[model samples]
Target: MKKIILPLMVVLFTACKEKNEKREVSFPEEKTVETPKDTLTKALEEEPALLSLDDVADTTFVRLRDYNRDFVYDMKYATDDNFLKTKVYDCAECYVRAKTAKALIAANEELMGQGYRIKFFDCYRPHDVQKKMWKIVPNPQYVADPAKGSIHNKGGAVDITLVDTDGNELEMGTGFDFFGKEAHHDYTGHPDEVLKNRKLLKETMEKHGFWSIRTEWWHYNLTSASNGKVANFRWDCE
Candidate 1:
């Protein structure tokens, strides 16, 4: 019995030692490797600089395309699709004063939260273009007098409508520049959908430092820009 007990004890000790050795071999001590920090720096360096209105002057005219790409454009005077039946503008471009652009961008941000965005039919009409439009229509209700100068000539007014995320235009009772009583804000002859659409546009614009005339539902002017001087600076088409 002594001889058998001694051999069993020896066997158990050997087995325990081997198990401990295996455990040590399975998991070696982890090394401290230095990670490269340049990866984050490289990523930031590769990113494009963001645009902002901070550096722009309030009176300076800015191309809206440079600041925001979400706004849609149909540039009426650039084509013969307007009441004039003549293309008076050399090109289709949306320009506005820096302050006006800031307001527009803010208004668009709010509208986007509601699944809508502003689509511009006209913006920042040059004084020369206003004169050309006057020559064609000569209607005070439709086009502002060149001598008096429009808010558009001052880079403050925009002819716009709302569109859903899918790009379908909201029904505003009439098309842009519709010269009739039906387009008036007081006109309640439209369907509920049209009235709601126009109300949304008017309320949103007015909330963002803009004011609308009673006669035109599409026209909105930045109240702060009303005092700006008329401009004739034409944007390059290219």
Candidate 2:
């Protein structure tokens, strides 16, 4: 009986020891993950749409200043500073066909890359203003015939010169609306720098789809814009 009781007690003590030594397995604690933010999408959501030629019609007239701010404006005919010595325009505003404006913006960008920008003397003359200019000059060589209509009346031409980044006009050997052989592209009597400047302006303009006439150094016509209609619609000054 003693041997049996001792064996039973030993078994019970062994089972109790095994139960006390046993431990449940534990895993690592979980951590919260954070997602990265998309900055480009956030910025695009906050920004407005940019102006583009795609938003405008090719033949539609657009205010040049509204589209580009790099150009400098003199608008000679808008004041008494031109050869006509008359302010024909109601105000000094530059407007051009959408196609012409696109070409000019491209040309001006190229010029700006070369440390120069286009300074406008005249742009998109009204048909009535063209008639007024013809009455003042009365010469086809000096002014375009209003009956036939100039490219300016058609919103395809710009009278421009090179200006530095500081807005100082480059010496092109002739002022805007200067009616003489000196303004002629073939005339080689000017200084080397003047010739170089004129060549830069001409070549750059021609490269951007403009053609210069033999009579005017400041004038350029957009080849693509030649087919546009003559416009007499005036811009309000207020």
Candidate 3:
């Protein structure tokens, strides 16, 4: 009887010990995550959309009849055979430029009854092409370096002038990107007509969601939002 009772007790103790040792597995505690709070995490400020001349439904291509109040004397970087007619123009190459095929068409329609047109001196300047321009004059005083980049590369900037109905360029004190006192807006030595013309250009572009850069009278940007990231892309024109 004693031997049987002791064996039973030993078996009971072993079962109890094994049961005590068995612990329920636990998972790690959850960690708290934080979100950034500020403008850095927010979307960029957007300007009001300018009217586009080419409706989404339109498949046909139209020529740019003029830039600005049509000055019979306006000029362009390239003629029809050499230039592109894309919606964005040479944006992959240069900073956002003005007078995009779309933008030019819109501006023309707006100024139609006024007897004005658009002309482009420089558009869709490529980064490599900008390098060439800088190489010609390593001075940042005139051209922004290829290393630094220009607003024109963004496809939302433009250097423009006005032309009259007769195709005469409205006289500005100096040509585009001219680095001299002649280009200064306050240079009263220039003719009043030139100053008025510059102001007109600024007002027109500003009304259409563009801002004139202080240094270059004709230089304008489509706000910071439109400037976007300058695409480091190689285009066929480049």
Candidate 4:
């Protein structure tokens, strides 16, 4: 009877141990991490929102880049690559009257849809810069008389060309600021591709309220900005 009882006790102990080892256990789930709302607010406050063109007055001068980032810039006067052969501007900035900016942005959007973009060589020349250009090339045909003030001085004009997605400027018969009959809108000496490229630029700009000059294939003036006062404020380079 003692031996049987001892065997039974050992069997019971082994069974209890097996059951304890096989018992199911659970642990608390980890919480998901999220950024704090105050941290997000601080981040937003660091970067100011871009202003809309509609919120600005039409005649007010504004940097084109501030309103739209789509247009490409190769401001010639800012460097010595222009007809002046001198860096007339402290920095390369494209500023136009708000009305001009609105039209240019619209025109660029149309060009972009056709897989091309507008590349600016000049925009909104200050009165002093115009005088400097006149001193270099006093030809009224090329450089407008500073006393008379050209559309550019009025923040109404832009010198531009079309560039493909690869940034290769389309063959517009002549380079920007080229003063020759070949650059004329009526000049038919160019190849068909060049004519087509010019037509695309001219028509698109006209459709968006800009008119092209008879001589400079690259120059366009916003119709509404024709009466704006000539501006002379220099942009801060820093």
Candidate 5:
């Protein structure tokens, strides 16, 4: 039987080693996400002119769903009920982020040469859509309550990470949605290569105007994410 899946909620950056691979550092796992009910509305009321994913004029969300590959551990993209409108994303900001990221990581040709690509776990989530994330995980300490809003609603914060040209997921310390201390970035004593790779990912993204949240290695917010914001907008995954 053929099967398809979306990346489960990818988690923070950290380090680890396989049977033969060396170790490195990873992101820490602190718990608890309290989202506000009217957070998006408040943000929108405050910055009515702010640009959101909805504002992007031209964008295309490449459908990973169509690809038949072994690399994706689709957790975020999966659904108990085959979800509709869950494939397309507001692609403008993403494109900008990716383009800028490309320039920032230009010096590190190794990553580029290997065709390391970024796959987003969550992006431009609406307060309502966040409900889906929380339901999927249901861990209040890690996943926020959908009744409350998420940063993703802002169309700024995106959870992502590196995959090879072949779409193979690289080993980061922990699996996505792991609510544990091993995910912590400061957690050391692993191999050096993993740590270095994590750093490479972080530094490169930041160089291009992306800011990493302290808790999530794969998560980043664009500097312009908040430019002319809109809120309480309907959230659709596709």
Candidate 6:
């Protein structure tokens, strides 16, 4: 009886040892890899949160770049290349009313889906700048009177054109600020390609609550900005 009991105890001990070995082989401990502190901090700095325009008042003036970086800016008035032939703005910056900026962004998004984007020639002219423009091209057909104030002075107008993904400007019969009959939207004397490009820009802008004048293919005014008070405050060049 004593020998039999001793053999059973040995068998039990061996079985327990085998079970422990299998458990150790089946599940190994996991190793954790730590990221360097500096690398993690750099990544966070590169992707700061963008400000939202939703809480801003519709009439509030806001820089377009702050809300979205998708649009291109030429800001012709900020340079002598414009029809004015002199720099009117202190700097080349695009500032529009919050409402107008929101609509422009929406329009740009739609155009981007089709491989095109909006390029601004001018945006949100201050009342004084409007006067300066009128002095150069006083014709109401080209420049709005500063005394009465234009939609641009109200921060709701934008002169813009479309550019393909390659940054090539779309042909629209005539270049921006061209004071001629050819610049008219009704002018069908242009090639089919020019007309199609103009149609694409006009239709998209109209869909986003903007309207164009008969003489300038690049000019568009936000419908809601018609009643906005003309603003004389200029943006800081900094």
Error of 3 at 9 (Å): 99
Error of 3 at 31 (Å): 94
In terms of lDDT, model 6 sits at 0.90
lDDT by residue (tens digit), candidate 2, 182-211: 999999999999999999999999999999
lDDT of 2 at 16: 91
Report residue 102 deviation for candidate 4 (angstroms).
Answer: 0.5
Indicate the worst ten consecutive residues by lDDT in candidate 2.
41-50
User: Candidate 4, residues 1-238: lDDT per residue as tens digits?
Assistant: 9989999999999999999999989889889998667854575566456679988988889999777777788999889998778999989999999999999999999999999999999999999988988998898877789988999999999999999998889998888878889999999999999999999999999999999889989999998888878889788885
Once fitted onto the true fold, the runs of candidate 5 whose alpha carbons sit more than 4 angstroms away are: 1-77, 80-114, 131-140, 145-148, 226-238
- Predict model 5's lDDT versus the native: 0.51
lDDT of each: 0.91, 0.89, 0.56, 0.89, 0.51, 0.90
Give all TM-scores, in the order shown.
Answer: 0.79, 0.78, 0.55, 0.79, 0.51, 0.79
How far does residue 153 in candidate 4 sit from its true spot (Å)?
0.6
Q: By TM-score, how accurate is candidate 1? A: 0.79
lDDT assessment of candidate 2: 0.89
Candidate no. 5 TM-score: 0.51
From the highest lDDT down, the ranking of the candidates is: 1, 6, 4, 2, 3, 5
The true-structure Cα RMSD of candidate 4 reads: 6.0
lDDT tens string, model 1, 7-106?
Answer: 9999999999999888844567799998877864575556555478899999999998777777888999899998888899998999999999999999
Better of 5 and 6 by TM-score: 6
Clashes of 2: 0
Clashes per candidate (backbone, < 3 Å): 0, 0, 36, 0, 37, 0
Error of 1 at 105 (Å): 0.4
Query: Residue 132 error for model 5, in Å?
Result: 5.0
